[model samples]
Target: MTACGYRVGGQGASLPTEIKVIAVPAFENRTPWMRLEQRLTAAVMQEFIHRSRYRVVGKEQDADAVLRGAVTSATTTPVIFAPETGRASAVQVAVRVSVELRDRRTRATLYANRDFVFREQYEISSDLDSFFEERDPALDRLARDFAASLVSAVLENF
Candidate 1:
């Protein structure tokens, strides 16, 4: 005889069940990148809205908890080079971010990650006339990924 059972995959919510609302204000940008904070903030808020049932807000006073994020640093390094021109053809953009989630009433930190780093590679356009800024697209993707990761970390209390 054999016994069979089913199990769930996720660890489930680790924070207090009383926290039903969260405020995600614009993240601070310590780096030189322009408007990077806005991108990160918007992405994180959107992720929370899409994935969780919590009521997300922009003002801390309107929510039970608040999530604060900051872009610590950003740099782009050449990863691939062009054969003929000997110029950089691809770059790896690395960004460091710090985040914290705290209860508004108690001011207790629910989650904190001081130095979370993420990197992505973007190819440079070969045609100079058609060249466009790749940083924006890369940053957008990075922000989305960071948001998903941040939400997961908070939910898992990691």
Candidate 2:
């Protein structure tokens, strides 16, 4: 029980107590977006470091367990269009990811999710000068949201 008397699902309630250190390597990018894996991997590592008691390491051999992930698919689709120019006014981005956490010593899988999906919607600027400017920031926000959800799910053994 927590101080509030009700425990949240991701307060390391299900994670093994012995897992004091974790390895988070660069996620594999199976999508066409270059360096997407790097961004996701970095976000996940940062989340683990900031949100949990586990120490994060770059190498698998130095950790008690390892968390591996891959970005499987990414797509951007126009969801809303401007009435005047018939151009996309808003777009929706969808991403699929695969994640796995395993114990190095016991060779046991702690958590596995092969089809984790995440989506975000961003407004497309009407001005040509700022059209592409929203993309990176949108992706950054998506990555952070994905990391938070992924960390919670992993911690809860969901």
Candidate 3:
């Protein structure tokens, strides 16, 4: 039992204890976005390093398990429009990602999600001079959120 005197799900719940090290490679970008995969991969690696007990490696040969990511689709849509010019005042970006984790020695699949999707909206600039490209920043935000959620999934064995 936990300090609260009640177990949440199971005793000592987590990924396999043997998985002491993890490797994360550059995500495969199936979409048109040039380096979105790199950003996402980097974010996930950073999250694991900061939040998990396992040692993270950049190469699969150095890890006990491997976490693979692939970006499937990305799209943008205008959510809010300027009343005067009919121009987009806000836009939403939707991204679909596939992720998998497997033990290197046993070759057993630990976790896999083929259709994970995340969407975020950012305000567009209607005023001139105030606009300075926000899609990149918005994507960074999305990557961070995705990484956190991914880490949680692994930690909980979800």
lDDT of each: 0.84, 0.89, 0.84
Best by TM-score: 2
- Candidate 1, residues 38-156, lDDT tens digits: the string is 98899889888887778889999999999998899989899999999888888887888899999998999999999878787878777775456655676788789878877887777
Kindly list the per-residue Cα lDDT of model 3 for residues 47-138, writing each as its tens digit: 88888778989899999999998999988899999989999998888888998999999999898989878787888787666665765777
In candidate 1, how many clashes are counted?
Answer: 0
Please report the candidate that would top lDDT against the real structure: 2
Count of clashes, each model? 0, 0, 0
What would you estimate as the lDDT of candidate 1? Answer: 0.84
Assess candidate 3 and give its lDDT: 0.84
Model 1 residue 47 CA deviation (Å) reads: 0.8
**Compared with the true structure, what per-residue lDDT tens digits does model 2 show for residues 100-129?**
999999989999999999888878898999
TM-scores for all candidates: the values are 0.86, 0.92, 0.85
Q: Please state the error at residue 8 of candidate 3 in Å.
A: 9.2
